[model samples]
Target: MVDADQTFVIVGGGLAGAKAAETLRAEGFTGRVILISDERDHPYERPPLSKGYLLGKEERDSVFVHEPAWYAQNDIELHLGQFVDRIDRAAKTVRYGDDGTLVRYDKLLLVTGAEPRRLDIPGTGLAGVHHLRRLAHAERLKGVLTALGRDNGHLVIAGAGWIGLEVAAAAREYGAEVTVIDPEPTPLHHVLGPELGGVFAELHREHGVRFRFGRRLTEIVGQDGMVLAVRTDDGEEHPAHDVLAAIGAAPRTGLAEAAGLEIADRAHGGGIVVDERLRTCDPDIYAAGDVANFPLALFGTELRVEHWANALNGGPAAARSMLGQDVTYDRIPYFFTDQYDLGMEYSGWAPPGSYDQVVIRGDAGKREFIAFWLSQGRVLAGMNVNVWDVTEGIQKLIRTRTQVDPEALANPHVPLDTLTS
Candidate 1:
């Protein structure tokens, strides 16, 4: 059923959009594939922006998805530094760039991704304030970290989320003093809950990172267009040479909203609503990556995952669906983080209230353990810290929703595969 005349338009140049174009060709579509991105750089993965790249351990070219010649060799139309302003759904045309070049598509895909949520406080426009969503941001931040390290300056981070903590670790590696401020009692409170959040707090503290908990950043005090200090609601000022706003990211659904596509409410994590096949309200259009909110039958809930894994797999799934292939995307939510000496991978979704108890195996004191969240003896989620090659077994336990004895689950002697069996 391949249509030679059909054109598939992908909006956004992030990993999801780029991978979708790759999938289309690999699936033998042979249709006109056009990818438009506002960023001048080619498609790239974002994990390195906070990890190896920020620490200057990896080269700038490592983040890109493919070589520049790949697109040209594949006969895919690559439009860089062009923003698609509007989508005329009735006519199936997208108007993009300054001259408003209109391109018609047989099927449209939105991988528009997300933007970093900005700090509303004053002095955010100062030269030393930064956000880490794009490669450009990381490039600027790398130089800022290096300068801070060279001058023995201080960095004040506004949030203790993944981005904040990762950058804090990277800054420490560069020998910069770091202070993390968060309203929560501990870092990663929402994701790991208080039970395991303390582990990360301890890990950072051991590395000499300061934590200013139970407080909000009221304002960024700057002088002469450079950050001087940060003030907390408690009326205390901390000296800072640079500030990082890692508050989180908001999905970019403006074009989809304008196109009249169904958008999800905040309770379900605001994003464009999509079905199992990743098809939006308008059948001819579909969505993937951080922008799409699709159902996870395993959790019996709708989730809009903003992690790299979601975008990595979701893009290909959406492409197959768009190609009229039978597709049902129900992969378990997975993400990993590397900070200082601790490397962890988490599988399944278990937010604060979803699980009743957290069972831990191995040694939490040694920073090598697997923590499992359970609800009435059913495995909801699992996180393995510095414990290698157990992701497959942990994922199986969650997918099967296996009921196990708490003692056995907590005993490292008992194999994970045995519990599932």
Candidate 2:
């Protein structure tokens, strides 16, 4: 039975918030769970925004992390389409939308996620110009993609990050003429490095996708308030019936910052700083998911991971920590992406450009391989591309930090266990 007087308020109705509520109830916490979300939809998984959902492979309901009735059945109160104006730490209250009443809470969870970084270029707000971070954005983009059949629908995509490439792949499948524009000579070079990034670039190229690399969009040319084309820095203009900017996202930390929570500086990913337990400077408040730049005890570093796994796993950990359970959010960070026929899963965290070399155990030409990032003969991180049932082995190598010969590690005949040993 839930306690009548105690209340636990969760801000942001994303994956972390929904999971936090579920965990609180499953853990037998008899306190009120009030989930507040500015978006009207039920808390949903966001990965589908670029892939499954955008491609129409997933239904609208399937994108939701929880069913509509789950909250009511579990006795979790929901405040959908409502924004939180402010958080008063000293008063232990959350002020509702401007002029709304305060909702008192014994404990608070800041699970607010990130938002797409928008372009400041001219005509960005015009029709047919899109930036995706929400379900509504993806839904609107569906029409533009379908327009490919009506006429020549040319899509000009800005940025070549994970989301950018995935969206490009999905758009191409829909028969749109996709062109990816980015300042980087190679897509994903910042994350995967040049060698692997080149492979991905080749993968997309073989599939008929065009790339305008080493270019930046200076303006979005428009006609009668609708986007027509994008002008590059070098005075080159590309025709665009629709434009999608997948530049990146920034952590939504306005509420946390307003309440005087400690936020990490740019060097540490610029998110709400929390300890290993996901507890903020104030014991009464905890943060998780994309907004929380918590310490990684295993790697001796801090990360603000905006991936599904971190949000899915960190929610329960934050809930347990809130219930005073001896907990540590110290799992090795992991993330995955899909483009064309290539699917990749990566585990472990190394500082920016920290790995000295990468060892490959499978054929890159065939796109079936496990690539390990090694520093001083020890595995620091690894990724498996189009390889099956090897994530466990890859993660173990990262967790154990085992030193292995580069030659053995690169040899496919050598069993993964033997190389680690």
Candidate 3:
């Protein structure tokens, strides 16, 4: 039976918050649970926002992570369209804007995820300039694309991250001329390293997408409140009918900091600090998903991964810890992207200059290959394009820390399954 006196209040109705609430119930916590979400709609998956949903291939209803009736059946109090104004840790109360209602909690979970980092350059507030971080943003962008049609539209995307690449793919599918600009030498170079990033760069180029590497957007020129062109740092102006900013996201740690919790700076310099159990400095409050920089046992470093798998898996780990269960949030980070006709999967983490060896399996020219990164004889990371099974096998190898003869891994004839044992 749930303790009637204990009430678990979860803030931010995104995937992390919703999953935490569900896990609490699954773990036999019968306490009164209240889930507060800023969005009017129930929690939904966000990965599709830059892909299928933006392209109109998937409906909004299909993106929902869970149904409203499911929450009701689970006895979860749903507080939709509510913004948490402040958190009082001493009083254990949350001030929110739900018809001026105040809610208190015995235990609190902060799953408030990050928002898109916008370019502060000129003309950013123009009608044609946008950012893709929320459902509404994607919907608005889709509407513009549909209205403009395919014939004579141009989309200039800022940043070469997953979102920018996915949007570039979608825009090209709509027959729009797409150009992606980034300061990095290649897309995802910081995470995937330069060689694998070069493969991706080539992949996008073959799809008729233009790339402006080592370039940064200095200003957005607008006429009558609609963006007309983008001025780069090199003083060159590129005409663009639409502009989408997908630079990256910063952690939403205002609530945690307001609660007087010690917020440590990320090793990579922009995320929040949390322990292995996803607990912040204040033990009573826990943070997960994109907002928390949890320690990665595999890398022996604290990192913040904004991937779908991390949010889904880490949320429950935070909830279990809150329930007094000893659980550690450590897993090989994984993320996937759909570009053109190919699906790419990435597992584990290895920043640039960390990996000592890289082995390419299969054929990159054929667009089906697996790239493996090894550090000190341990599999540190793997990237697969149209070769998911190979990536899965690599994941197991990384998890088990299995040592393999470097030459055997590079040979195409060697079965990946052989590494499982």
Writing each residue's lDDT as its tens digit, candidate 2 over 1-421 gives 2355789999999999999999999999977899999999999998898888898898989999888999999999999988998999889999876468689998899999998888988889888888888999989887778786357689999999899999888888888898999998899876777767888888888878899999999999999998889999999999998889888889999999999999998677888999989999999899999999988766778888889999999998999988888898887888898887889998887543788888888899999998888888888888899997888887888878888889989998888877666
TM-scores, all models, native as reference: 0.99, 0.97, 0.96
* lDDT of every predicted structure (CA atoms): 0.96, 0.88, 0.85
**Runs of candidate 1 exceeding 4 Å displacement:** none
Q: Using lDDT as the measure, what is the rank order of every candidate, best first?
A: 1, 2, 3
CA deviation > 4 Å runs, candidate 2? 1-4
Off by over 4 Å in 3: 98-100, 266-269
Q: Compared to the true structure, candidate 2 yields what TM-score?
A: 0.97
How do the residues 1-421 of candidate 3 rate in per-residue lDDT, one tens digit apiece? Answer: 2376798888888888889989999999988999988888899889989888998999888888888799999999998889998988888889888566888888888888998888989889988888887888889988877755555688899999899989888887777888999999999878887888887788889988899999999999989888889999999999998999999998887877877776667446445677888877777788888888877777877788898998899888989988888888887899999999889898988788888999888898887888889987778888888976666687887887788788888787888779767
Ranking by TM-score: 1, 2, 3
Q: Who is ahead in lDDT, 1 or 2?
A: 1
**Candidate 1 minimal-lDDT segment of 10 residues:** 218-227
Candidate with more favorable, higher TM-score: 1 or 2: 1
